[model samples]
Target chain A: MPLDLPNPTDLAVPGFIVLMLAEMIYGRMSGRAVYEGKDTLTSLLMGTGSVVAGLIPAGLGYGAAYYIWSEWRLFDLGHAWWVFVVAFVLDDLAYYWVHRFGHRMRWMWAAHVIHHSSQHYNLSTALRQTWTGKLTPGFIFALPLAFLGFEPAIIAFVSGINLIYQFWIHTEAIDRMPRWFEAVMNTPSHHRVHHATNPDYLDANYAGVFIIWDKMFGTFIPEDKANNPCRYGLVHDLGTFNPLRVAVHEWVGIVRDMWHAKGLKNKLMFLIGPPGWTPDGSRMTSDMIKEDWKRRQAVKEAAPANIAAE
Target chain B: MSLLQLLGSVIAVFIVAAIARWLFPVRFRLEDAHLHRELERVYPDLEPEEILIDRAGNAALLRLSGARGIVVVRRLGDKAVLRHWMPGTKVTATRTPTGLMLDTDDFTEPKIVLDLDAEGVSRTESWLALLAAPDGHAHAA
Candidate 1:
């Protein structure tokens, strides 16, 4: 029997409206304002950017899938329901990589930085997304799922579900879940670690619905209540709530650094190098500062009288 | 398109639009009424040109164009007096591949100054680099 095609757009509207309304009510109840002036605009811009980023590649994915499936009449995958499940799993698997790369890569980080720039993590934070991400990484992996006898609708629906499920995990209101559930799923606790800028928690957990990927990939670090309390946000915090700044601050910083760097090496390092890599032979890493202090101490000991006179 | 197909297409388009709107909004209205009121109080003589609220830095830069001189105030808390536009002095900074270079020839010979504070101070040769290129133009190779 043919699988009944559910409208992907229909599912998204109700889900988005419900989420927004829920965020507002919860925000009020929790004594957290839903939208801060200027922040609301920033959030909205970031949200729109993410959708635009997702849509370009997603649109192409749908077009190519439709072309191949229609040509071959490969719609009848015998086990349509199981195929949907497999598609969903594959989508989640792809998302895990996309999510991880967004954290690890410098260019990808620029787009993703907007999402984490907000110190306050709430439902609205989930909406803060990047518009230019698609141009950078490009969603090419989804093509394989389309090639493997899955309809575009199924793929789109599964992708939407994966995104929708991750929203509730953005809040601090929900603490630890049951032991068993936390063991297998990417709960809020795990996600808090992911969002934290703490030294130990950086680049730790990268999972969508399942924690298995992080566990399997050796990226999984459990919530250590004593050692690491999740301190939300990036290292060089963007202090303003302005959305446009939140979205393009890194880009501006990149251009600024690139312009000021003296050589090609410094220019490339500023744009494509790891975050906080400066041309002054100085690094922002914790270890670098410790070494600098040690060097100063050694100098002071070597010339105690000179140091005291100064 | 069949009935199901038509429904699916409409649904897909709508969902994409909603997500787009949810993610990238153009205008940002004030979320807190109190904050808005406070901003108004801080800048009672706020001219439209002086109200520089840029979203890119998450900080607003305001320049009060007064008779005496321009007063620059950063939204986060830094207030400084900008030097009046001198005939020979350059006000704009240009970026380059290398470190910043100043336009003035006086920058050819730069001096390093180290101010003493709670933290012990140390002066390096590089401190003169900024002064050497005081024109604010970045000279990139």
Candidate 2:
């Protein structure tokens, strides 16, 4: 047989649609709104673009992995069930780092910001993806799995599986899963915290398949419903619904900042720094935003008691 | 996938998407409690319970009891910009054939227009009355 190299995501397209419809139905029956027309269309368009834009880069990434496996692999870990399992775990770990870096680093964030542009979180929001991730160095994160002697094909397969597992978590239909399952796996609740832009929920729960990574890394934050209902989207909102603008808005922001920057150091910092970081102390990072919110909240909390004492 | 298969997948995806849109629709739910909670968070001193929120939460309009100023919270993506309309704030709340137009001092371009129903118009009138008052927090409406 000719070396069958088919994208696994292609096979999952039908299933994705079915689950989206199911989620919409469940949401309606449960009296929680899950879908918006323009938002859904925008998300779908982003996904379509991401997949198409990803083609050449995906080939390059796979080729690099294959080259390493063939010429420079550390071990000849042959095609065994355990090897596949190991590859799966390693691929997931790679995904976690790629995702984290996508958030932290400005260049990666320019691509990743498209995913976070949607205000409403739903099945379609899962479809909201980055058209420019291919241009970024994100694929380098997965090269380790291939270098560890797993075939590039196997790595690609497991990566697809990882993505499919993550798809269901991008939803509001299913609340908290079983306590044990929620503790172990990345549930919808955990993912909701990841998607939330609220002060408490910002930059927490960056897990792909396992919640263990977030917990181990100390980035885990539980969903708090009583105090703060999860507000989805970026801190500074993208005021436009145009899909093209949504895709390139952050990239444009990065360019603008770099162009206005005084020196080479500042221009480079604009590319490598965090999303909200500026050369000057004007803009706030997620850390700064969270700290400011905490201080304000503390003041607000103490005000009534202080007044009473007075 | 072949060209035919690709076309088929596209058609199927759109079909499903269309169904989802039809089922859910895009109507912003302006819950009284939710609005009150949000308002209190922003303006802690203002009476959240006494505040009136329009049912059409598209362009959320608010009027506090005995307060001359109106609060218009515009939803942009996930983040909302809460525009405070004090007595001194150069903001005009006019009723158009389509809905209510809020021309404010903050944003000059792409004016704030809300597709208010009859109830929303009445509520806007009640809130705008506060802006017409000479003294702040003295108006009943």
* Best-matching candidate per DockQ: 2
Candidate 2 lDDT at A149 equals: 82
> lDDT of model 1 at residue A100?
81
- Over the stretch B3-111, how does candidate 1's per-residue lDDT look in tens digits? 5644554454345435434543334321234233433433333332233332232222233233221212223211111112222233333333322222222211111
lDDT of 2 by residue, A1-310 (tens): 1134567787888898888888888888896657766677778878877766756456677678788888899998877889879888888888888899988999999999888888788988988988887778888998888788888888888887888898889887777899999898999899989999887777888889988999999999999767777878777665456778888888877888899999999999989888899977777898887897898889989999999999
Please tell me the interface RMSD, in Å, for model 1: 12.7
**Model 1: DockQ vs. true structure:** 0.05
Q: Alpha carbon lDDT of residue B81, candidate 1?
A: 11
Model 1 preserves the real interface contacts to a fraction of 0.03
Give me the iRMSD of candidate 2, please. Answer: 4.6
Candidate 2, DockQ score (0 to 1):
0.22
